[model samples]
Target: MPDITLLIVDDHPVVRDGLRGMFTSAPGFEVLAEAADGREAVALATGLRPDVILMDLRMPGGNGVEAITEIIARGLPSKILVLTTYDTDSDTIPAIEAGATGYLLKDAPRDELFTAVRAAAEGRTVLSPAIASRLVDRVRAPQGSTLSAREREVLRLVAKGTGNREIAAELFISQATVKTHLTHIYEKLGVNDRAAAVAAAYDRGILG
Candidate 1:
């Protein structure tokens, strides 16, 4: 088989250099180019059309999520693999939602990273163990107990001590709508009230 082609995107030069060197020395992989941020990554991807894009989330120019979304929108052939330091739901969920083929942490072993890249190039979903567990937990709730994104948003605000009226205003929904969301949250979390709902969310790792 031909070597898998890659575009490495990261804001830090040292990281870029290290990734380029690692892939260059590895078998069955080719570093097509290096990009400093999302914008450059998009531009390079457009021109090179590499087999895989190794992306970092936080950057000065543009973000990995934006790049992934745009690449998918433009229907680029390159598969995106997120290699970031952040594993939080806020970071991992959006990247996956934006069309990343895989999510891996920066601390991953070199062999694991290589395997993830290869899997991404083949259009397979690849997630690090931590990210995989989080996604599973997010969807593995009992029947009728999974929280929707909107419900999670409401619960997050409630965890911060935001009142129903305040959450309504912040979310641009009616207080009645906020109440409906809260009711669902309470049911899903198996709680009786706001305080208990918040506590349950945290305990379930849904809040964090």
Candidate 2:
């Protein structure tokens, strides 16, 4: 496999410089580009086609969400991992909805950040442990049957953002059943994936 190329997006020079320095000593990771704002990030990402992006949630000139959306709409092959200081549910959900494959805190230890970058390169979703509980709490909340009892159960696991295989074992259902349920839930909620479904569930008052 090719070395993982990263595009760092943040408005702060210190943050960008620190990230660049970290990656400088980290193997298998390269800083392909750097941008001070979202628009610059998007433009550089488009032209450079880096393998991964370390995006900040809050930035001027379109923000990380806007960059993610633009990159996805353009069908760029790079994956996005949010690297921000914000740990609130608001920042978390929107980042996912905007097509981020991973959410990470900026203050994470160097080892964790390295691991997360490797995981993101391999197309795995990574979430900081601190915000993982919020997903679990949302799953535990009582809600109406926007989905069937079984479907609701599936969606609850989904709201917690568990992978299909994890959901299958947790629910004692086959992977096929998990996919079928996911398809139905997406159709019902007008979403396309765990991220969009989570967003829809929140927006439609299906979850807390």
Against the hidden reference, what TM-scores do the models get?
A: 0.71, 0.68
Best-fitting candidate, scored by lDDT: 1
Worst 10 residues of 2 by lDDT: 137-146
Off by over 4 Å in 2: 142-208
Q: lDDT per residue, candidate 2, 9-28, as tens digits?
A: 99999999999999978778
Q: What CA RMSD would candidate 2 show?
A: 13.2
Best by TM-score: 1
Q: How displaced is residue 124 in candidate 2, in Å?
A: 0.2
